[model samples]
Target: MQRSPNLANSVSPTNIGHVVFGIGGSTSTWGNRKSYAESWWKPNATRGFVFFETIPRKHLPWSISSPPFRVSENTSKYKDYDKHPIPQAIRLARIISETFDLENKGVRWYVLGDDDTVFFINNLVDVLARYDHDEYLYIGMNSECHSSNSLHSFEMAFGGAGYAFSYPLAKALVTNLDVCLKRYQTLYGHDHILQSCVADMGVSITHEKGFHQIDLHNDISGYLSAHPQSPLVSLHHLDAVDPIFPSMDRKESLNHLMKSSKVDESRLLQHIICYHNPTNWTFSISWGYSLQIYESLIFPSILHKPLQTFTPWTKVIRPPYFIFNTRIPSNDPCQAPHLFYFDSHIENTTRGGDYILTTYTRGKIRGLPACNHSADDISKIVVFSPIRKHHLNGSRRECCDVLRIIGRDAAELKLRDCLENEILP
Candidate 1:
């Protein structure tokens, strides 16, 4: 198997070499099932990448003779219809592993995906560059958590739309599947099982937010629009099309869409290259501990901090009280803080009262004094403080009174000094 030319500089034959695209189901989107595979999946399988489609025994088409891929079906091993899709897919993957003799091939990367996926190989290549071929078992995208007790929150596996695993890792995964499945039986979803299984193996899972799995009804247009510049391994349009021939004539529509859409290859490649930049920050944050107040507070304050810091290592001077500590969550998109600074210089200055305070919960900007000095218009002198829970019911009067007693002149001088020394050059 050959490797991606872009990765030829770094990826050796022994490194990440082969890409296995797992297409499950008998759904015919184009003319036939096999045609769907040839038109949609095969072209993306560049030099080093191999495409394999897994279909149920009943759905296997005869035209698929001497098919480059092998087909696996649900057997007596999976008597439980309750576990239909997941177990069936797993079994098929195992069969592929054995059929290809991948166990001994030292194949490091295998992308487990669906048939409906349309991928920009260039974007995928960018994602593959981040990890060496040795590191396998990667999930392309994750589903959003909507509930507090959702089991999905506990693990990091994305929609089973598509994922990649190293050959050794896949072997290890199959070896450990029975135990993992037994333990996490309470978790109903396949993705949840995947998460629990991989996490138990201690395999690091890389999540690509740009990888959209079109499971919902309205997702087709939304996903298609997003894909032009998306760094997606592949899109999984599960149940988006039926298995029967001429199913809604969607294949033609899809083909037409792909043809009509102006996919700027250069722009798409640029988008994928830049995709890793945003993710670098996300991966940097350790989610081991719960977020803290200070962490929350600093997140917003340092929204542009990374961009600034990475620019020239040029530190952004901030107020003395505005110290940044990773122990507390900063105003990160993932863990945004409740408090935010009100910059008058910026347009749409909603929060510009005597105290320059804004409601963190409501996102409303209103002007008010640090104290009840509404007439003073001392917005510049009084720095807005975060509404800590302890300050509710006006119980923390001492702190407020102390600042008020310091007087506007002293406060202005202090702020000016801090600004000059800390923020500005």
Candidate 2:
């Protein structure tokens, strides 16, 4: 595809101000899920609206930090809309059309997401910056579970994960969405309907790894800890997955992640690997989220694969558990990873330069013995990284050098760009 000349020489860069969000919500569900949207939505600075079915009755006095609410137009006029099991799918799918009709000025992209979707705003801006907003673009990812993909479409962008439409494409969608919605009233999900409409326009989805549907249930630590080499954008379906951080409730866990996200949104859950050669210990740091320590040296190829720590979205389990390569978690002491969760972080200014110090505390102790006692004493990990966004377009993930053990209970490490021709053996 040819780059638009206007975008190529564009003096102004795409920022949060250029994107408008359309949050799919309802009066019944908005009260409980508003906190997730509030976590990322900035009042006045961020432009967008939460489209609810009706005015929220119980949750009055909406806070300023949350996105201002807009009630969706009644979809009762559409034929056969009432027969759909989840009739709200019609309203939810029309979010793009509703959002575009408002005709917010200077809007380059229209971001669509559920109320439970938590966007990493800065990272989102950075990801969107790579694309030409003047073109007809539809960007998003399919579900993590293979079953979900098989049932709906691997090509469709799951709405809960959030997706983006460029200005031109959104305009086209607004014009035809009502008729398209009528045609697809039998479709079950909002995302599928949207994808069908986009397909009618001959526009296929431009998959971005950063947008996560998070369709799995129970513990999702495995997936988050081994993120793809992309900017962390949005996470959805938080209510189904276990709390990202151990011990904390779902809301608190998200708040805990916000601490590190605020420090460097681009680096949140960015995977970096290093080794302590003497102990043959492999350290996998999911920046700002969790850390996993292996007693024996694990090659980057194996380390990069997420452990199968989550179950499929449905009870019917079949082949192809996940869309990505996942290693089955082992009961063997040698293979089991010692877990650590993000504890705190601080900005450090020194003679050399500015950096961040993030500490990870050991979680609950498993009864299994540590392999050779190499990682037994270690209770905390302190990682130092440059205070800048790690560019995702780079050829490889940034490398890390395991520093000398600072204490009996803690270890330290430093992250830097991988030296040219350098490989993790």
Candidate 3:
């Protein structure tokens, strides 16, 4: 592909870097979609040269029309959309490399990202300045989904969110893809395949924790409110309901929250509500109704019990709330899960007052007590120790001492027995 002379001269050849922001779907959607392009792209267009690519939604079920920007049509019959993104990315990278004469010209970097990404232009420039262009592959945010290996630890490079590659690295990736696609056609998902390919080729990837993607659906106001202080250069709003700046409905709410500096608090409370009684089908459909009942009614009741027990000692110390059975079930049992608990006194001490109570059994626990008094059947309980924590810094120690005084193995063990026998029955 020949470079347009006008485009070549319009951008400074010496300082010209390309930000290949890839947008998929038809032209109308791209125009109307609540995205970073609609909000921040035009405003910050002067900061660096901008180029756009639209992945043609031909083989995918989403759309059939040609989009506004240059479209890469996936001629292959593969129905799985996840598999095609990387090949499309590689193709775009090659186009940029050839057009810019990446080797000869002083095009220092190439940033690749999705349409949903909102750029913090000033912060990004600052971040880019710290790295020497020759050796590093800088990823904005690392993916929580992929695991890293010893040979080449997988720090997920954001293919959907934004990631920047140095000129040499971008060139090498483009060169490498020609061979990679030919050898591995079945590896479908973009980020995973890219991670695998890069690692296999002996490329070292370093994570810059400052890069983040907006993957969380439940908490929008809280996330964006933290962005100003956060080291992240780009925020990728991957999920639905992202305000994306200037959108009337959410933007007004966001602005009101930001003005009061209460966005985080509001978002936190909202999250608590959703966590307790989620309305979305995404959450309810996956896990069975029993799981929902545990989260909504049973666990909360158990967690609140410690408060009642310790409440009378208000002069010396406030009673703590025990959060139990907080872990989300996984396909595998070995993976550790997150749990939290808090005491009123301890809550007053920390920035975020809630502290973790003690963890439960590693294996599944059964015969847990029911919240309803009439229920005779004890539900089976599965407790994972690492998941739980006490609210006080030394509360676990205190609990252990109390357990020993009462002739028990450990505080956790004693508590487990008490809940199973006294509380349940």
Candidate closest to the true structure, highest TM-score: 2
lDDT tens digits, residue span 1-425, model 1 = 22346665664543223555554443343224443344444333332222333443344453432224444543445435345345544443444344334434545555554445565444455555545665545556654222311325434544444666666666777677667556665565545565667778887667655465543332232122212223434544433433111223556544432331123221221111000121121111100000111111222233322221111012224422111121232233434321221122111224332222211111122332222222122223223322221111112111111123233221211011122233211
TM-score of each: 0.47, 0.96, 0.44
The list of candidate 2 runs beyond 4 A from truth reads: 1-6, 80-86
Note the Cα lDDT for every prediction shown. Answer: 0.37, 0.87, 0.35
Candidate 1: residue 15 lDDT (0-100): 25
Local accuracy of candidate 2 as per-residue lDDT tens digits, 352-403: 6788999999987755777755576789998989987678875689889898
> Candidate 2 or 3, higher lDDT?
2
Clashing pairs for model 2 are: none
Selected candidate, larger TM-score, 1 vs 3? 1
**Tens digit of per-residue lDDT, candidate 3, span 1-425:** 12255544554432223343333323334544434444444332322322234543432343223112454444243233344445544443334334334233445566655555655444454455445555545455554222212112345565545677666666676667645544544554445455555666676566654466443343243233222223335655433544423223554533332222221121111111012222110001000001111222223233221111111101223212111112233322222111221111111122233222222111123234433221112122111111222121111111111111112111111111112222211
Candidate 3 residue spans exceeding 4 A from truth: 1-28, 42-68, 73-104, 144-154, 222-230, 238-248, 251-425
Index of the highest-lDDT prediction: 2
Instruction: Name model 1 segments beyond 4 Å from true.
Output: 1-17, 27-36, 43-69, 73-75, 78-106, 144-154, 219-230, 238-249, 260-425
